[model samples]
Target: MPDLALDIAFAWATLLLFGGGLLLLRARDAMHRILALDVLVSIVVAQLTILSYSRDVSYYIDAALALALLSFTATLVVARYVTRGRPF
Candidate 1:
């Protein structure tokens, strides 16, 4: 029963990730695309956290953290570029 629940949760997460990816690709405006990308990154982090919980692995958490940091930095760079025309 527990395993079945986990499977269902994972399935939902996968669907959300797919949807977010599609949204990111379909966005017409730069701001909308940035928001969609953030959503996609968030979904990836959630999936990683769920995997870590189900598999009893710590490395997944570490990987998720690293991904989050990268996402944050990228977002900042992009925001800067969008506002000021330069990322660095």
Candidate 2:
């Protein structure tokens, strides 16, 4: 079973995820989409952390950390690609 408050937070995060996806799709500028993507990733990390707390499991935290790092790296690559036409 999950903690109620954390579960509510998770639900809110899911809602934000949907909202972020909509924002990303609605955004016309490349930079605006990138910003929306970052916000989405941050919200996902928060959700994962909440899941870990609610479940009393340590593995989700590890997954969340990995996700955060991956998101950071991916964002950097995408930003670079946007600016340079190549990820490298």
> Whole-model Cα lDDT per candidate?
0.90, 0.90
Per-residue error for 45 in candidate 1, Å, reads 0.6
Encode model 2's per-residue lDDT on 1-88: one tens digit a residue: 4467777888899999999999999999787888899899899899889888877899999998999999899899989999999999
Q: How does model 2 fare in lDDT? A: 0.90
- Find the 10 residues in a row with the least total lDDT in model 1: 1-10
Segments of candidate 2 deviating more than 4 angstroms: none
Any residue pairs clashing in model 1, and if so which? none
- Candidate 1 lDDT, tens digit per residue, 1-88? 8778878888998999899889988999888898899888988898898899899999999999999999999999998899899999
All candidates: TM-score: 0.89, 0.85
User: Which candidate ranks first by lDDT, i.e. highest?
Assistant: 1
Q: On a 0 to 1 TM-score scale, where does candidate 1 land against the true structure?
A: 0.89
Best by TM-score: 1
